[model samples]
Target: MQTQCGGCKQGGARCCCRCGCHSTAASGGGARLCSLSIPSGRSRGGGGATEICRSPREGTRKAGRQAGRMATRMFEGKDHARVYQKYRFTPQEALQKAVFSYLDRKAGAFGLALDVGCGSGQGTLLLASRFQKVVGTDVSPAQVEEAQQAPHPDNVSFLACPAEELPVADGSVDVLTSFTAAHWFDIPRFMREAERVLAPSGCLVLTTNTLDMRLHFRDRDQELTRIFQEFRDLLTPYMSDKVRLVVGDYEEIFEAVPFPSKERITDIVDKVPMSVAELVGYVQSFSMFQAFLKDRPEEAQAQVQRLQERVLEAMGEASPEARLEFWNRQVCILASRGPVPDHDPRS
Candidate 1:
């Protein structure tokens, strides 16, 4: 006999509090935000899960803050990066919102949209709708395979390749972009590849979201704030020296690449709602989480469970069906790469 999974039966299967695995569902019809809900049990294929009872009131601001603090303290090494990559393995649903979020800001016609580090082609499919062609590539073979299976326009394709060596010919792409993963990249080499593949009038778009909760809560929510402060402290070490270099000033770094474009930079502040379980799922997708699990299995497993409880506890009267709003800052750097320089033979 198969066990009935509470999460799968209770509307959505992404929230398995028992297993610390979460699912993300995108709103259909191209909504700008992706909504997440917490389910009760582990996902066991089909609908197999066991339900357990805890106070729906367990989800409180104070608990979530504690979970966030522990999470921050846990993910501080290379192991967490591995966990971060796995987060992309779950669903491509977020791609539509993420891609549309950028394209809606772009002006003029674009021929091709290239997504670097396009794990599983979520963004690739979204871009396909707006441009003549879309190409998504990632360094992981499993991700490439998953991306290949996504429904896409004839003009959209997925490939497995490192960011430093994209397969496309020089100047063949019209728009090159990345979402959230640029910080993990070899900044100089990735920029060089972007410069090489983009057409004379092509554009390079890069954006990343910094998770901030202080913007989401009132002063009465001190517990939530403490949790995030801990999370931030935990994540500070492995942010990659390269990513740190780009912080505070997108201009200085863009110029370092000599992208040769009139640049337009913008900052978008958005409120994202997530349950405590969903928050764990989000962090599980980060590199820090991956690194933590790889190098410290016992610690990682314990931490994941602790985080789940804390998140649920912090929900603070928010309906299990309700949402938790967290603030984020997305920085977009759009640099236009003009025509290539004319090469002249030595006199």
Candidate 2:
């Protein structure tokens, strides 16, 4: 039997949560800010999830002071940073809507939009057309510098800072987001910074694509998918446990969100098309893959090359010319600073 999304019972089976993990970033380690109740069980297939639980929160004031104090060498190397800037997929239009649709309901000015963990600034630049000013902040100076070097409007800027701390003044940011990178954060501590920076009724959106990804080719979808899955499985051991937060759809992160007016949207799917070489570039941008390379450089290089060769073999084609569709499921967690509004959260 296929299970539905616990959030909406809309589609797909849900994945089970093994995340009994706890963090000291907040008080009362497992508390739920259940403005939106979560289903009792795990999500499966393309299932949606409605979750609730408990986790403590850090001091917002303290979070602000810690900003600019920690700039880790995250995504530091020149080649890695360049690949991250070039290969990382931008947040698709649907994901952006998941954020903006909620923000439209908000009551304050939409002057400043801050993107935490804004690696390479793809998502950050998307905000420029809407917000008066946009800032993308990351913990890696290298990533920040790459974002700066990119051609962006004057209204968009970049910074090197950690998620747990932000250098901005209190109640300054109108909309805050962390795309595909919140899993690497001390979420409870980061939530404190989220609370610190957002203006009253401001929106905070945290989003990431789940691991149930698929690679599709015109007539060879299933085979290409198997190959991709094989590649992912090989890299699994290299992935940090931090990725579990994403697999769990940020349930723990939601639990820790200091706000009471929070909800989630699940099963947002996006399909990006790329050539075999380009797909390899995207995979190479994975920090996990980078870790694998660090541990066994020759083996790592050999593995990806093998993956490329196998894919071409499967395609029965030359030149790696086959363009394939890369698909992913997205989950977005949205929280409002002050009160829950009267309109439909889904609306």
TM-score for candidate 2, please give it: 0.77
Candidate 2: misplaced stretches above 4 Å? 1-73, 340-347
Q: lDDT by residue for model 1 over 1-347, one digit each (tens)?
A: 12233323444433222222211112211001111111222232545333332222232222233323321222223333343433333223343354444444432245557787766665556676676656675555445445554455666655444666665556656678876556556667777788777766566777665544342434435666566567656655545454463465455445555565545344466666666555666666655556665667787777776655554456454333434655655555666566433221111
lDDT of 2 by residue, 188-293 (tens): 6787788777877678888988988888877887998899899989899988888888889888888888888889877899888888888888889988899889
Structural similarity to truth (TM-score) of each candidate: 0.62, 0.77
Question: Which is the leading candidate under TM-score?
Answer: 2
| Segments in model 1 whose C-alpha atoms lie over 4 Å from true places | 1-108, 150-154, 211-222, 237-239, 246-252, 264-266, 317-322, 339-347
- On lDDT, the candidate that comes out on top is 2
Error of 2 at 1 (Å): 60
| Deviation in Å, model 2, residue 178 alpha carbon | 0.5
